[model samples]
Target chain A: MIEIKDLHKSYKMGSNSLHVLKGINFNVEDGELVAIMGSSGSGKSTLLNILGMLDEADSGTYVLDGIPIKNLNETKAANYRNKFLGFIFQSFNLINYKTALENVALPLYYQKMPRKQRQEKAMKYLEQVGLKEWSHHLPSELSGGQKQRVAIARAMVAEPKVLLADELTGALDSKTSYEVMELIQNINDQGNTILVVTHEPDIAQMCKRIVHLKDGVIVKDEKVKQVRAKVNV
Target chain B: MFNRDRWKEILEVLTTNWFRTVLTAFGVFWGILILIILLSAGKGLENGIRADFGDIATNTMFMWTRSTTKAHMGLPIGRNFNYKTEDVETLWEKFPQLRFISPRNQLGGFGGNNNVIRGLKTGAYNVYGDYPEIIQQEPMAITAGRFINQSDIENKRKVAVIGLGVKNELYEAGEEILGSYIKIQGVNFLVVGTYKKRSGNGNGEEGQKEIYVPFTSFSQAFNRGNNVGWMAITAKDEFPITSLKMGIVNEMKRVHKIHPEDTRAIGFFDLYEEFNRVESLFGAMSFIGYFVGILVLLSGIIGVSNIMLIVVKERTKEIGIRRALGEDPWSIRKQILLESIFLTIISGMAGIVVGALFIYGVNALLDANGPVDMFMNPSVNLGVVSAALFILIISGLLAGFIPAQSAIKVRPIDALRTE
Candidate 1:
């Protein structure tokens, strides 16, 4: 579902330039659950940003769902992100003023979907994430686990081709993190391609495959026995 | 563009801090209120001043002879001259631009010895001998009987038109006034009419203490044969009396054999020029009203802009999330602009409503009491309201412009990174 070859990215901080992603090659097939593991400066988040089409690489070949992602303008990039990719940020990133149902319906709103249908679709996703009863509550009113579930429901409501999660449970406790992981695994079980970015090894174990990045380069790639998160939850 | 979701989002964001929203709105409210009030007050003052002119023809001049400053054609300098009855006919035949020329003769002064007496009552009063057309030039409402007409002048009838003040002084309440004979300087003249000045300047009370008699009768009774005191002349609607003044004066100078360049001779008052001055003063007042009102409104718009910038800053994270959720940059910009415009229009409408109520209350108070001097019927017309609404829309756009730009410039990635 995604492809990246020799991707490179750099940031200019005053006079010095920091290379965040350098000569990285990665690929993931459809329906695969992959965890990208890294240290603080390992360039894992930068790769996911490029894969999610949030940022562009200075030099690379990247394709998602048979469409190459290169030199796209902001508007087209936004459309592609809406149609083909879903994102779960560490901070939940739900608009605080909107109720959980409204937050989940935001992507469809941008898609120009009719309001009635958008609400129904968002409600289905909220139900799938086990947050149907909490849909009317705001993000601030929800627990970390419930908020993460709402974020997951929002991310999946549009049924994007790929799901990108950057430390989705970073702000939650271990118990809540496991609960969110169980939800993610359940979603991936339904054949949605998902990428989880994490620094924690236990979280990485929950995925079917692991990709390790160190100092802007991938050091290891392996397939492993998937540990089902619902068993722990 | 008419999206329910967008509207809901705007309402939610704006209502989150309702106090700040109301505070921001108050600026525009006060601005429009002051603008309407200034314009209405200017209109009121114009109306009041215009009312002082009353029904008198503004395009009229009152001309009288003065002592000549220079000798011409054997006429000595400093020679005091009086315009004769023949000079009135001479002017009428010479100047086709003149509409009405009324020769007037007067006897007695207000503070002089008592010149009028009836039944042991004696009082000092001014009496004017005028033609029939003088009523059209210097308008007054005849309260009883009729004004002196052409038959009275032709037949040399001893007829008079007394003012309401003269009537009150000479006759008791509910007494017979018309056809009654009153003695003027020991000459009995029949009272024909009673009049009151329509509008009061400062001399309204004094205007009611005058009397009018036919010109021929005054000349015969007073032994002033064919002599004219002064003339009230009105020009045609197409011509202005001020422009025709020099022409008429020069003709009179040539007829009376006065020096052509004698500036002091034939002294006259140009009512048209004075009326023009008052008209220009009205224009200046309106200009000042607009200038000051716009300045105040501009400050209010700037305040709105400042508040919008703060609002955008406060909602940066929210904007970031919307952008990340595939909201178009234009859509985000539009949302901010819509919120700003909505706030401005609402506040401006409130200001208009309150201002209208204020003007209504003032008018009601004025109606309950009497008319106030130099201020009447303060109001703004529909055009002014439409212009204010147009200004509100444009200023709303201007106020939202900077903040909307800042909002759209936010990159979702960087914005999402902000704490």
Candidate 2:
């Protein structure tokens, strides 16, 4: 479970204070697919970044599995991010030079696993994403859908409790986007909690819950009907 | 968690930018090469200088009497004086420290003066009377010849050892002068040997025009009448020869039966004093050479350091990636530092080996051509070479210090942002 309360973040841009995130509260439970909805400048990505431990909040009480994250330093936050939460950025963020399997092996480099074991585990995860035949292809050689599948494989390989994906389908066309949503639905069904940030309501309607934000404030948080997975058989 | 994996990362980075890596290492390579060449050249110069002075004999002392008198041997009052055979003998036997003795009879003895055979076919020549022991005092090389021996002196045999110049002028070209007869001062002396002149030593025509004979024979035949123009000597050991010079002076007084206060009867020179003067001059020159060598080494080291700085600056991004991927700062620092030291050691060895081979090459070439004089088989001492290698390693560290420190200081956030 992940929990946040009274999150406030700000930055000074040449003497003018930019309020990137205002006060807010949010939560994600086991096996939930939640969507964070906002338009541009709505603090959705900033909020996701703060929750993913990629950036810090100026003021907040973050409780991940009942442990407070506000006091965690950079290294410790990275550690927590590695162990408890997996991140997927809008761009897929695969290191362009690495193959699919090697990209899946990124977090394991920090896990201190032996090379052989890490490769085998990464291969297994790639197989689960149905991209096992493309394991040796670099991101540039893979389609947008295939690259996102590789990123999801990498995020899920570590068995983290929370998958915080920021605009996971932002760069894919409609068909590829549905395929990615279907893959995300399958992953969440496997008992991982996912919090995806996107601007489109059609994408948000696919999740079990939706959290709407306006100027960094949580305007609404409500349970929604689960849309059936519509990826091609 | 890190260990050798960090090295793998570094190797990846190096391979990714292969040209940059080699260029960085080339800086160290060039530094070592220049260092080695400079050092070897300095050694060669010192050797060459010593060779030029080889004939002058580093440990020898020469003394010539200035003419001063009230009619001791000639009839001039308070005129410059010269030595006599009696004075030489007295000096040789009395001063125990005087190892070898040679007293010049006169300067106008020989050289281009034709010894006429039948008053028409004149063979131009020069002759010197020297002891066999005098050969050991200088680096004199004998070619197809022999020096005078004790037997020649005992028999007073009329024989001469001619230089190449004398042999060429007297005997027809390409003719062997050994066993040939040469007439000198109305006397036929057998040519027992032929010697080549030493050009590397700074000795003037005196070295070229030597036609040496048994000293006793020359002393007797020339009607020298105990008169010598100058004398040279070596110390029994390396101790100062001043006291020994005084001992000779006292002996001279005894031989002439003159009172100690009767200084007007004879004159002497302190060649040891002259030798010291020349030695001090060389000492100063060698000091300057050493100073210049050290300065060159320091500049080479600076070049290495500057190269390392550039390498660190260029690789900052790669350093960030490594640290982000679970690499400890220590490992990053170690990899960069090891790369630097390894580069220096390899290049340093290349320099040293090439430098050493150069020395040996010159030694063999010179030993074959002729006598090498002071420059023969010039070599750097083994201990000194090892010390130089150690200095190279230390120079690597100094060159890489700032870069390695920067690698360690790379913050993961800043590095990733540099993405």
Best by TM-score: 1
lDDT tens digits by residue: candidate 1, A72-99: 8888888888898889999998888889
Q: Please give, for residues B1-419, the per-residue lDDT of candidate 1 as tens digits.
A: 57877788778878989998899899999999999999999999998988889879999999998899998998799998888899888888888888999989999975788899988787778999999998999899999999999999999999899998898898999999998899999899999899988756988888899989999999999988998999898999899998999998898888888998899998999999999999999899888888888788888889889999999988888788777778888888898889888889999999999999999999999999999999889989999999999999999999999999998787878788889
TM-score of each: 0.87, 0.65
Instruction: Judge the docking of candidate 1 as incorrect, acceptable, medium or high.
Output: medium
Q: Model 2, B202-267: lDDT tens per residue?
A: 445556666778877777777765566566777765656766766666566555444555565545
After superposing candidate 1, which stretches have Cα over 4 Å from the reference?
Answer: A65-73, A189-191, B36-47, B70-103, B110-114, B117-119, B131-133, B149-158, B183-188, B214-228, B235-244, B247-260, B286-299, B356-387
lDDT of 2 by residue, A1-233 (tens): 88899899987789899998898888788799999998899898789877876568899788888888877654565567778877776767676656899888877867767789999999999999899999999899999999999989888877887888889999999788888899899888888899999997888999999999988898999999988658332
Interface RMSD of each candidate, angstroms, one decimal: 0.9, 4.2
TM-score of chain A of each: 0.98, 0.96
Compute the lDDT of residue A8 as modeled in candidate 1. 94
